[model samples]
Structures are given as C-alpha cells and as structure tokens.
Target: MLSAYLLVSHGSRDPRPEIALQQLTELINQKQQSYSSSKKLVGLAYLETRPEPLHIQIKEFAHHAVLAGCDSLKIIPLFLLPGVHVMQEIPEEVALAQQAVGKDFNLELLPYIGSNPGLTKLLSQQMAEIITQAWVLIAHGSRRPGFQQPVETIAANIGAVAAYWSVAPSLEAQVEQLVAAGKEKIAILPYFLFAGGITDAIAQLTETLKLKFPAVTFQLAQPLGASAELADLIWDLMKE
Candidate 1:
C-alpha cells in the first residue's frame, strides 16, 4: 500500500515556525526519496492560529492522498510534550477526519517528536559547547498535571534545571535560585522547536534579568531549528 506523511504543529502568526516546519518537511522528503519511489506524499497541518482549521486540512489532505492512490497516512506531531493537544485535541481531530474520509484510507498518529530519546543527546551536545556554572531548560509550560514530567526528565538527563515561560519556577525564578546557589554564570536553553515570539520573549526576559542581577552572567541559546539531526529523528519516528 502506498504511504503518506502529515506533520502537525502548533501554528503561529510569526511565520518562523511554519517556515521551519516546511524546511524540515523538505529535508525529510529528500531523505525518503533516496529509499522509495512512491513520492511519499507529505503535507502539513496546524492546530491553531492558522487560516485553516486542522480538521479541514486533514480532510483536504486525505482527499488528495486518496486521489493519488495512497492507502495510509501517518501524522507526526511536532510538539514538545504530551499535553492536552497531544492527548486530546489531535486525536479528536483525527477521529473526525477518519469519519469524513471513510475506511478506504488508514490514518495513524505517531508520537510527539519531543518524546524521542535522541533529543536528549541533541540537547546534551548543545549544552556541552557552552561554559556555564548552571543551565535551565525553559519550555512553554502546560497547566495540565503530569505534563511537566517530560521537561523535568530531559533537564535531569542534561544535568540542568527545568523552568517555564507560563508557570511556576519561571525563567526568572530559576535564575534567582541559581544565583542564590552561587551560580553566577548560567545558560538558558529554550526547549522549543523554533525561534518565534515566545523564544524572542525569552531573550527579552534574559536581558531584563541581566539588568536585575548585574553581577550575574546569563547566556541564551537558540531554539531547535531545522537541522539534519532533527530530520533524522523525524524519519526514525516514521519508521516506527
């Protein structure tokens, strides 16, 4: 049976994340072309803040794939955590799409990209290049219980502390804690997929913190952008 791939991400008006996703998709398709001749039809869908709703995108892609003789479609979420979006929203949309497309096509939802163990190695590699007394992995926190565990686990694996943009133990608080512990030089790594408004906010906050704590040193790293390693991870998820 012919197979197709659909990548879903939290859409934004900033355009950077969407552009990054497109680049990643191009990289993935290029890699897949080396091993397959089926063209491996790939499409992108967004969860929110985009012009089209996710369900509409899913249906449109399903119809296109059906016309192209595709028998199955796999969806890979480009989110960092298994929060409400991963746990409830995407699945619900998929179910609705399935009903609209009928049984002629099979739809499968893959795990979120952040759950890949290879990401820990990636984060570790990024951290190793920087010299700092302390590090904080800052993510866009979720209010749902148990959602923070993955961020915390990743932080532990990288020997860094976990901080958030929206919740408790925020970037500022984490920096304060590090300062209290006599950690003057600290690095703040944004655990995001791309550089967008939130990542820009993180940079601004770092500047503010620098002014507040004039004696301390703060370094901010770039977000995980379109990289070869990330494309490999997406391909790995597809294989699974």
Candidate 2:
C-alpha cells in the first residue's frame, strides 16, 4: 500500500516553532503504529522563511512518497482556521503540486485545526483554568470579516462551559472594551504560537491599558505549544 502523511504548518524562521512541528509529526507517527500501520510522516513549513513555498513543499513531499512507492498522501494543515491562506492559497498550491507529482498520487487536504469543536473546547477549558477574572482570547484578528466567524464560534463554544467571563476580539478592541467596562482584573490569552510582532504590539497596548485601567491587572498566557491533545487531534483527523 502506498501511503504517507504530511503535516503542514505556517513556517517560522524561529527554530523553536519549527521544532515543535517536528515533534507533532513524531507523535502522529507513533499513534499510527498502534494500529499496525506504518507510514512515513513528513512535516513541512510553508513560507519564505523556509526554502520551499507551499507548492514546492507539497510537490517535493509527493515526489518523495512516489519514489518510496506510496500511492496516497494526506495533508493536514496546522492552521487555527480556514482563512484565506487555507481556503484559497493552499488549495491552489495543492492543485499545482498534485499535477506536478502525477495524477495518480492520491492527495487530500484535511480540515484546519480550528474547525474541530473538540479543539475549541480544549482552548476554552485551558483559558478557564488559567483565568479567574474577565479575559480576552487574543487572536491574530483579520481585516477580512469572514475570518471572524471561526474565532466567534470558538468563543461561543468556550462560553458554553460557563467558566469565566470571556470574550474574543482583536487585542486592541478587547483591551478597549475591558477598560470601558471598568474591569479591574484581566488577562490576555494569545491565540498564536511564538512571540512575534503582533504579540509584541499587544504587549505594548496592554501596558498602556494597564495605566488607564489601573484597577485592572493583566497577564499573558503562553501560546498553545505542542501538546498530547494536539497530537491526538492530528491522529483523529488522519483516521478520518
């Protein structure tokens, strides 16, 4: 049987994030072995930071699978949502890759991580465990209005748990709303991996808000790193 797995994520030059992806792939492979199916798992990062763009990445992986005599390839996008990159850009790239590798290569793009209600529940539970007061689930907000629904869904699903007063918004809007509401204690949970420009900007914004809402305290939680639950989620996707 010709079969292989590819776990694709947003590429980062930072070694830490890339390393985490590698770890996630290893976990997937480990789980697959329990079912007596042995297939090579490859992890690819898509961005200029990496040598391969999405097209090249998928094609190269497909070529490797073909050479290895595998007939099927499954791609799992590690993004949090089905954004423009996931919906338009990645699919187009995959189509090109499929043509380049050969029509015979069976390839599939799995759903984005954020689409899973299980993962959303986990995110909400994680936030609830950490925050005893009002907080914002900070995400990489998009100007595209369509991008907001996934975040809204996650927030609503999380709210269903009734753990704490939680809201989802761009960092700026969240901060502003919290201050206006006279909330004294607040926290921000970054919905991203790795600290970068956006996280830094949120920090700066939070500092200013702290002074303005002196009664409100702020804390930032670490981004969801590679964890067993994530590893499980990947396995669940691949099984489907």
Candidate 3:
C-alpha cells in the first residue's frame, strides 16, 4: 500500500526550526526513495505559530496524498517530550483531519521521536570529544507530572542530570546545583531536534550562568540538527 509520512513539529516563530523541519522532511524522503520502489510521500506540519492551523494542514496533506494514490498516512511527532502538544493537541488535530478526510484513508499516529533509543546514543556522540564533565540535558519541559520522565531517563542513561525550561529545576538551577556539587566543568546539551527560540534561550541562559559561576566552565553543545543519523532515526520510527 502506498503511504504518506507527516513529520509534525511544534511550530516556531523563529524561521530556523521550520526550515530545519523542511530540510529533515527532504532528507527522510530521499532516504525513502533510495530503498523503496513505491516511494512514500513525506510532508511537514506544525502545531502552532504557523500560517495554517494544524487540522487544515493535515487535511491538505491528506488530500494531496490521497490524490497521489496513498491509502495510508503515518504521522510522526518530532517533539522530544510527551507533553500536552504530543499527548493531546496533535491527536485532537489528527481526529479533526480524519473527519475531514473521511474513513477511506488509513491514518496512524506514531510515537514521538524522543522515544527512539538511538537518540540517546546520538546525543552521547555529540559530547564524545570532551573529557569527563558533568552533563545536563535541557528540554522544554512540561509541568505535566509524568512528562519529565523521558528527559530524566535520557540524562540517567548518559550519567547526567535533567533540567527544564518551563518547570522547576530550571537550567540555571541545575547548573548551580552542579556547581555546588563541586563539578567545575559542565556540558549543557539541548535535547532538541532543531535550533529554535527555546534553544536560543538555552544558549543565553548558559551565557548568563557562565558569568555567574566565573570559575565553572560551561560548554553548550548544538541541538540535534538534520543529520543522516537523524534521518535514519525518522525512517526507523516510520517503519515501526
């Protein structure tokens, strides 16, 4: 059966994240074309801060896929956390899109990209060159009780600590804690797929923290951008 893959990201006012998502969509399509005779159509959608509402975009993509003879559509959330957007907003939009598209199409919502185990390894690779330093995985955390678990799990896997942007144990607080714990050298890794406003904020916060803890050395690593490994991760998620 012909299939369409919709890579949905949380929309951003900053163009960088949206551009990165489009680049990633192209990468995924290229990867799909390389292996499959029946090439799957790939598209991008955003949840908010975009010109089009998510349901409308989903409907448009679904219609386009249907016209291209795709009987199935799989949506993969590019979010790193199982926040309100992932758990509630996206599914609600998908339901609306399904209603708009009718029952003839097979639509499925896949797991968030962060659920991929390979991602932790990918993240670990980013800091491989550095010597032993306390690592902190920063994410756009949700106040929702269980949302922090994935970030915590990833941090634990890498022997690091977890910090949030929107919740308690802010990035600064975490850095302070690490300093108090006598960790002089620290690495702050943004657990994000692409560079956006939040990532920018993280960078700014790191700079401020560096000034605050004059003795402690803080190095901020780049976000997981559009890479072949990341494209492979998306393909694997789609296959699953």
Candidate 4:
C-alpha cells in the first residue's frame, strides 16, 4: 500500500530550520524510495510561524496524500523531549487533523524523534572528534514534569551531563560544576536537530563562557543536522 509521511518540526523564525526540515523530508523520502517499489509521499509541517495551525497543515497534507493514492499517512513529531508539545498539544492537533482528514485515510501519530533508541548513538556521533575532560549535553528544556529525564538518560548514556537552555541549571551551571571539579577541557554538545537562532545564541554564550573562564577551553559542537543517520531513524519510526 502506498503511504505518505509528514515530518513535523517546531517552527522557527530563522529560515535555516525550515531549509533543514526540507532536506530531512527529502532524505526520508529518498530512504523510502530506496527500498519500496513505489515512492512514499513526504511533506513538512510546522507547529508555529505558519499561516495554518498544525491541524490544518496536516489536513492539507493528508488531502494531497489521499489524492496521491496514499492509503496510510503518518505524522512524525521531530521533538526530542516529552514535553507538553509531545505529550498533549501535538496529539490534540493530530486528533483535530484526523477529524478533518476524514475516516478513510490512515492518519496516525508515530513515536517522537526523541523516543528512538538510535538517537543516543546518533548524538554520540555528532560530538565532533574531540577529547574533553567533560561533556555537557544541553537541550532546549521544558517545564513539564518528567520531561527532563530523557535528556538526563541520553546524556548518561553518552557520558555527558544534561543541561537546559531555557530552564534552571543552564549550561553555565553545568560548566561551573565541571570547572569546580578541575575539568579544564569541556565539550558543549547541543541536543538539537538543526542550527538556527538558538544554536547561534549558544555559540555567542560559549564565547562568553570562554572569557569568563580563561583557563578552560570549551568546544561547541553542531546540532544533529539533516543527516542520513537521522533519516535512518525517521525511516525506522515510519515502520514502527
């Protein structure tokens, strides 16, 4: 049966995230084509910054997918944390989209990107070939209870301490702890999917951290961009 896949991301004002999402959509579709007899239709949607809400976007994509002979459609959330967005908001949006999409089409919400076990391995790979006395795996953070556990789990798996961008115990705090422990070289690994305004801000903050701790060396790593390894994870999710 022919199917369609929708890669939904947290919308960004910066153009780079949309571009990267486009690339990721392409990569996933390419992977689908590689092993299937017919190409699976793929699309991108945003949770914010779009004229249409996620439900409307899903309806539109499902409309096209139905027209394109897709019997099944999967909406995959590209979120790393089990916050309100992943736990409640997005599912509610998907439910609304499902109503608009009607009954015949198989519109389903798959497990989020963060739930994929392959992510731990993928994150370890994005660390850039560097030796450091300590590693800090920082995420965008969420206020939702228990959301931070996954970040801590992934960080622990990769031998890094988890920090947040918008919440308490920020990256600076983690660095402070590391410094207090006499770690001179540290790597700041962004647990983000793409580089954009926040990553840029992180870079700027890294510079400030550098000046603040003259004796310590900090290496900022790139976000997990639209890479094939990530595509592989998404591909696996579609099947799941």
Which candidate has the top score in lDDT?
Answer: 1
Q: For model 4, what is the error of residue 109's alpha carbon versus the real structure, in angstroms, after optimal superposition?
A: 0.5
Each prediction's whole-model lDDT (CA): 0.89, 0.69, 0.87, 0.88
lDDT ranking, best first: 1, 4, 3, 2
lDDT of model number 2: 0.69
Q: Which is better, 3 or 4, measured by lDDT?
A: 4
lDDT of 2 by residue, 1-240 (tens): 646778777776567787777777777767777764556556564744766678788888887887898887888778886777788887887787888877778788888776666787567656766654676776776666566666666666665211112334346566666667776667777777455656666778778777777777787666677777778777777663
Query: 2 or 3, which is superior by lDDT?
Result: 3
Give the higher-lDDT candidate: 1 or 2: 1
Q: For model 3, how big is the CA root-mean-square deviation? A: 1.6
Candidate 4 residue pairs in backbone clash: none
Inter-residue clash pairs, candidate 1 = none
User: Among all windows of ten consecutive residues in candidate 1, which has the lowest summed lDDT?
Assistant: 33-42
Candidate 4 clash figure, as a count = 0
Question: Against the correct fold, how does model 3 do in TM-score?
Answer: 0.94
Name the lDDT value of residue 89 in candidate 3.
Answer: 93
**Better TM-score candidate (2, 4):** 4
- Summarize candidate 1's per-residue lDDT along 1-240 as a digit string, tens digits: 567889999888998988899899989988888865556788999999867778789989988888888888899999988999999999999998888888888889998998899999988878888999999999999889987898899999999999999998799998998899999899999999999999999999999999999999889988889998898888887763
Residue 103 displacement in candidate 4 (angstroms): 1.8
Off by over 4 Å in 2: 33-37, 160-170
